[model samples]
Every structure is written in C-alpha cells, then in structure tokens.
Target: MQRRRFKETSSLEERLDQEAMRLREHKLLPPGWLREQAFRKARQMNIAAHINEWLASPGLRAPI
Candidate 1:
C-alpha cells in the first residue's frame, strides 16, 4: 500500500481569506461573525461546566 502526501502551498492569510470568501458565498457567516459566535459558545460552555462543578462539589453545594 502506498500513502499520498499533500502539501499546503497557500499562505495563512490567503487560506483565511479564501475560507471567509467561501463562507460569504454560501450565505453563512464571515470570519468575524463566526469568531464571535464561537467565542460566545465557548464562554457559555465554560460557564455551564463551572456551574456543574460547583454543584457537584460538597463544599459548594450548600442550599441557599
């Protein structure tokens, strides 16, 4: 069996621009919007995880 190797010839900026253009063409989000959305999702996830951990810890589980 033979394996094929692929090379990335484009610069990082070029790749990013191409991706942003593709997103725009598809009526999806541009890079900034996508970044903001991802950040918001990550923040929400972190908050949820923290709350879960707080609830699970015996010291922090005291009733209000």
Candidate 2:
C-alpha cells in the first residue's frame, strides 16, 4: 500500500468552494417542487423524531 497527501492543506472557505464546484459539475440538482419535497421530507422526519421522544415521556405527552 502507498500513502497520499494533499499538495497543501486547504482553508475551510476554499474547501467549501471546491465542494460547490464539484457538485455543479455533476449535471444539475433537483429544482422547484422536487427540491421543496426533499426539504419537506427531511423536516417531517425531524418532527416525527421529536414527537416520538415526547410520546416516550409521560410528562411531555402531546395532547391527543
């Protein structure tokens, strides 16, 4: 096996810019309603987790 190393360390801003460029090179991302749906799904999952946690604690039970 061989080891590899970066020519030099990169700053946080430079790393983020590089990531954005790489993503753009990959065709295009979902847009409009599709993008909205993706975000909504993520939010729904987060809310579900919070609700489940609350339900698990009798003192924090949500009103039926």
Candidate 3:
C-alpha cells in the first residue's frame, strides 16, 4: 500500500469547510472565562457600575 498526495485548488465552500475543520481540531477555551464569571459575581453585589467607571476613567484621560 502507498500513500497518495494531491494538490488541488479550493472553492470558497471548500476553503470555509477547511477552516472550520482546522478550528474543530484545535482546543480553544472561551476568552476570559474566569474574568467573565468574576464579573457576573461582582454584578450580583451591585458593583458593576463602579467596575465600569473604574475601567473607563483611566482610558478616558487626555494624553499629556
């Protein structure tokens, strides 16, 4: 038995399918999962507005 290799151009559908297949083969964790849960817990404590304000203030400062 011999292995065969072929090179062929991919159609748009084929490219999309290949991309999906590659992603499926990878182990991807949800982004900031721990931070997301922490945020939810903090919101239950009615601190979400403070958190948003804290996050916004520094970024809002004008450049010197």
Most accurate candidate by lDDT: 1
TM-score between candidate 3 and the true structure: 0.29
TM-score of each: 0.43, 0.44, 0.29
**Model 1 TM-score, all chains together:** 0.43
- For candidate 3, lDDT tens digit of each residue in 1-64? 9999887686444554455445443335365665565445544434444454566777877899
C-alpha lDDT score of every prediction, in listed order: 0.59, 0.56, 0.53
In model 3, the Cα lDDT at residue 19 comes to 53
Residue 46 lDDT in candidate 3: 40
RMSD of 3: 17.1
Better of 2 and 3 by lDDT: 2
The sequence of per-residue lDDT tens digits that candidate 1 reaches over residues 1-64 is 9999989898444555555444345334556776676556555555665666667779976678
Positional deviation of residue 38's Cα in model 3 after best superposition, in angstroms: 22
Q: Model 2 residue 64 lDDT?
A: 96
Top model by TM-score, which number?
A: 2
Angstrom error of the Cα, residue 26, model 1: value is 18
For model 2, the run of ten residues with the poorest summed lDDT: 20-29
Off by over 4 Å in 1: 1-31, 60-64
C-alpha root-mean-square deviation, each candidate: 13.5, 12.6, 17.1
